[model samples]
Target chain A: MIKLLPRYILSFILLVFLQVFILNNIQFSGYINPYIYVLFILVLPFETPKWFLLFIAFVLGLTVDLFSNTPGMHSSATVFMAFLRPYVLKVISPRDGYESETLPQLKHYGSAWFIRYSAILIFAHHLFLFYIEVFRLSEFFATLARVILSSLFTIILVLISQYFYRRDIKR
Target chain B: MRSLLNFLVRIHFLLLFILIEVFSISLLVNRNSFHKARFVNFTRQVAGNVFVKSNNLKQYLSLTEENQRLAEENNRLLNIIESTYKSDEIFFRSVNDTIFNQRYQYTSAKIINNSINKKHNFITLNKGSEQGLRPEMAVVSEGSIVGVIKGVSNNYSTVISLLNLDLKISSKIKKNGYFGPLMWEGQGYQSAILNEIPLNADIQVGDTIITSGFSSIYPEGILIGFISDFTEKGGSFYEIKVNLSTDFKSLDNVNVIGNLLQTEKLNIEKQAEQND
Candidate 1:
């Protein structure tokens, strides 16, 4: 992803803008506050350096935190998700392996593969985020219900958003 | 030496990950206390400005609703003045009123950013320290209590919304004289849990909850919420849920309250405690 900084930067700004300005305002219910910005981490190129991946995740999470007034909550969750991304990718890799010609996009990798990949990371992020925000085990089950509901909502949002990203072959 | 260097290089990314996670978690843990790192304040300013820009576009959309609320509040104030006005009062009998001179000052602010869906919700206002705002001041909407100011920048301030789990406000049952600390239990934004009122307080379903005013933040008897549900739970105290009156969803403008006597009260109280 380092070689394609300009393209990723555009997506980064666009995704954060969408998350803070639009999605943050859309409260379907108190239980499910969808965070579609995790899509930025889910779509990183397969060959991204481990250090760079972690750095980008930290900055992205911090940006979300700064906007939402949850200082370290999003950053911690995003970094945890980024640290687990390579392992998740390895476990869910295609039998024929990733196509060098295609990045991790719904069109490139098929909807099923993309869903599995995004769902795992999104669920991990949401679970970590909700638990850490409460910082107590007293409301364990309620928090879990929230995590599960929000994760499902975020996954659907991430999937629906894929249709709107214009496929720019030049990038 | 070469083998050692290779192992260090191989695990360097793991080290970076650990370092960043530690830093982020430190910020989270540190936030539970009164003091925060300067970085968080800086970022809050940046975020506040962005929210102001965004809210500017949407300001017109809610103008009518906000105006109506303001008019309602004005009518209520007018009624209070009319009821208390004594045109035939003695001109020399101002002795009982001089002690009540301006105990609480109010500064109006516009809500620029707000979130109620989170376990820890916050409301950001467009007015900040430059507008004479300070942390720990009470924030009230119309005649009801909203939250307390938590942090303030030059141009913005963040409030720990009454909906947040971490906040607790001193409150009382208006029916009887019993008082308690009210806290949000992460139930929906409309409700919060009030504790420490004894079972014998003769409470009713629609009884109002108001600020105790024993604490210096909010002035005495400001409306907080009403008892929606109650049971004799949590030992001796009644575990009552209050239906918050301020519709946090539609909130636009609020007044930040500054208690002029807080410092003097605290100083005297501290001396008394030391003597004890």
Candidate 2:
């Protein structure tokens, strides 16, 4: 079942629904809006083409935007992060890039490396999303505060999801 | 044709990024109109429903403290009323009835969604159109004025929390009635600034800031904040910082002040504005 495309598609739909309906509604603090939908962009196969990955990120973000009604905020931010993902991966590249069929996960890359990689991507996405939401250098300090707080919340949610749903990919 | 196809495939990600950026830029530029505010209000309604349930859960835990606070506040209000009026007059007007034409009405509703950390902060309330809430009604929490209602649905309304950079209210010093423009400095939730007060005016720290009754939204004499610090800016005006009384971050309930004569006052003002 895990070998099939339908399995991943099913999981993706479920995650997106849960995100828009449940997680988006969960406001732990005013600052913490956990965006767990980014997991769709994160767990794509290692061999997925760069162009395909970027396109997936665009769709993933646009879907969230459609539900949240924030217009292009998530899409712009996600695409920018997707554009930088290659460089981020290169910087944190494992011994053999990644196994051909393995997806990015702690089970595949270990906790430390996965955490570092996810943190960079999540921060990059959040920084772009928040700054664009309120586009002004005059609001720099406020934007920075949002970046740190939202990133922390996003990271914690992502880590918890990763811990519970360990992927079947081998290192 | 094959070579062209390969070239297109090579730069697909860059094309996608450009497309999304263009979309975002357009949204930002077009955000000022009423259409956009209405759209944002719809999003607030969805947020409000979720908040209502969560706040309901917390209400159980915080009931004892909230009840005690409400009772003590009611007692203080009753004592003030008793001291000001004859026993018969006091008895004639019920506690909930509006006695004086200037008296402000208070409606307690939970804040479903509040964002103080953003440059443009908005708050979603659990009460709305059915509860006599309409656009432009003033909101206050714990005696200090928050902001006016910007949008309303049947069961919810979005408030422009005082922390927003876009909101400016007319406020006066409690002691002297010297007026200034009150706005959030886009910094902390607890602080705001009063701008355009003349430099020569007698100003001091800890002076109370209250609504000036100049606007139809908020009635006069409602507390805004306290003057914490001031400095001469640009040699003509004193820029004063205020410590906001309402803790927006921990805001649970608010009173949406329904002004009786707002529509009539606004029509007159519109006519005046047009003539000017």
How many clashes in each candidate?
A: 0, 0
lDDT over C-alpha atoms for residue B81 of model 1:
66
lDDT by residue for model 1 (A1-171), tens: 356778788989999999999988887766578899999998888888899899999999989988887878999999999999999999999998997857888988889999999999999999999999989999999999889988999999899878777465644
i-RMS values of the candidates, in order? Answer: 1.8, 4.5
List clashing residue pairs in candidate 2.
Answer: none
Instruction: Considering the true interface contacts (CA pairs under 8 Å between chains A and B), give the fraction that model 1 also has.
Output: 0.79
Candidate 1 residue lDDT tens string, B57-107:
888787887688779989998987675575436323443444557678888
Q: Over the stretch B73-155, how does candidate 2's per-residue lDDT look in tens digits?
A: 89999988777575766656564374455445667877766665456677778887888888778998877888888777778
Model 1 misplacement above 4 A: A1-3, B1-4, B32-35, B70-100
Full-model lDDT, candidate 1? 0.87
Q: Give the Å shift of residue A144 in candidate 1.
A: 2.2
TM-score of each: 0.92, 0.78
